[model samples]
Target chain A: EAEVAQSPRYKITEKSQAVAFWCDPISGHATLYWYRQILGQGPELLVQFQDESVVDDSQLPKDRFSAERLKGVDSTLKIQPAELGDSAMYLCASRIVAQSNEQFFGPGTRLTVL
Target chain B: SQQGEEDPQALSIQEGENATMNCSYKTSINNLQWYRQNSGRGLVHLILIRSNEREKHSGRLRVTLDTSKKSSSLLITASRAADTASYFCATDPRGGSYIPTFGRGTSLIVHP
Candidate 1:
């Protein structure tokens, strides 16, 4: 029953400020994903990481967002100069290499920008 | 942009009743998964139906996938107040990548 771990479960900040969220996947998981969920909508993929390398980041806004998993274990997502539209629930998920396609999710960080 | 769309955005049912949610996708998939998310919480995996499989069940939840029609349905029988949550359908397409597209979700409120 190991679960993904996320920090700063709730964050409130003003526009133009910098914010960062962290996630720690399951012990043996090799694939980690970052997603953003707007109100009344499903989660949208922002970036994906395989071990320490980024696999896909097409949906991520490069000008303001960046994610890294330097050690291939824990990951951090940062948004510089946050915007009002950035207020959403940031979720992290992880999947094992040889297991089923089910991805384990963390509690998520709820970001509110004023 | 998501590949799946769910019908009946919201539903309210009394306790001990059954709840059904339908989902439709636009592309060929390797698997279809159902997930539940309570208010202000993370998502919990419910069940998954592979492309080659037509029907699957877990506990009181039953999931059926029609690959030819590109549709899937999730049924929750004898539900309780705790079953009140938002349900989402995610699809992993048949290809090299592993990312799954998620639909907006169906909100179900089981009145006690």
Candidate 2:
């Protein structure tokens, strides 16, 4: 089965530094989502993309976080001047637009800020 | 929080035993989905029970949705060691938006 792909499975950085994570959704999937999962907590939506356009980013911290799916395929999420509280797992998910139901997730990038 | 709550945050059972977890939400939902996640990995889709449906089953997994009560339950019959994982219930609320709110999840340990 095709799976969502994420890079930098593990990342450790100092607070105030910039960090970015990448994700590649399954072929033909048009909807991509970014989520943050803190320790011992469920995943929380950060942003969602439909093709190359953003759908919902109500939960995203716009001041420090930004995500883009410019090509309507792969996506990138960035956090500038990361803070200690930003340490968490960043997960990417994708689903087909036409069918638009269940989401498939990537292994996720585990971020640790010191 | 729109995320909802799941009961019995943690459960342990022997192999071949059954495991059941219940989820309760605060809002009207279009559908409820169950997902499983092994430690340090991504979540895998399990089953989805629509609000219009009362019960659904796939293999050993059985899910029931009570929209009137705004609660859902997932039952795993004759579980195995491999069944050990964190089970989460995600709700897609009514309206056009399809973003799902997820609860903390129930951790299950099926010992062999």
Candidate 3:
């Protein structure tokens, strides 16, 4: 069904290290989102992008996290000096340009920070 | 967080049984959606009910929304072992075109 694509499905790292995840939204989708899903909890939005411009990042920990969609298609999320609490699934989602609510999600990256 | 909150955090059912989960929100919305995830995978969109619509159905899935009560429900009929997954309800933000907010999901276990 032309699903969203993500890389590095699983990652394990030590605390204070850095890691990055990548996502490629469905072709022609213009809106992208990054979410953090903790154990037994719903996904929490971290950042959003409209094409190449960031639309919302209020929930993002800008101090250590950064996300960019340089070409308005593929996007990357980076976390520096990861903390134990940063161990969670990082999900990337996208929606069609004309739609604002329905989103397509990618197989998220399960990060384990020891 | 403006997230929908679901009830009966978890449910256990046998194959061929019906499973129902409810979600409640606190603000006006343009749409509400239900998503499902397996043990460890990305969320899969199930059904979406718009503010102006009362109910919608897809396959064995049925979704109902009540704007007056700010609540919704998802019913999966004739469940299967593969139907075991976490279901989440998401609501469109009230004012502007903000990102959709999600509620803690209902974990459904279908016993074969």
Index of the highest-TM-score prediction = 1
lDDT of 2 at B82: 99
**Pairs clashing within candidate 2:** none
Which DockQ-derived CAPRI band holds candidate 1? medium
The candidate that wins on DockQ is 3
Q: On residues A37-91, what C-alpha lDDT tens digit does candidate 1 reach at each position?
A: 9989999999989999998899999999999999999999999999999999999
Candidate 3 lDDT at A51 equals 95
TM-score for the A chain of candidate 1: 0.97
Worst 10 residues of 1 chain B by lDDT: B92-101
Count of clashing residue pairs in every prediction:
0, 0, 0
Record all residue pairs in model 1 with backbone atoms less than 3 Å apart, i.e. clashing.
Answer: none
Question: Which candidate has the highest lDDT of all?
Answer: 1
Which lDDT tens digits does candidate 3 get at residues A1-114?
799999899999999999999999999999999999998999999998999999889999998999999999999999998999999999999998624658999999999999
TM-score of each: 0.98, 0.96, 0.97
lDDT of 1 by residue, B26-100 (tens): 989989999999999999999988999999999999999999999999999999999999999999877767678
Per-model B-chain TM-score: 0.97, 0.96, 0.96
Model 2 Cα lDDT, one tens digit per residue, A1-114 = 899999999999999999999999999999999999998788999998999999999999999999999999999999998999999999999989722478899999999999
Model 2 has a DockQ score of: 0.65
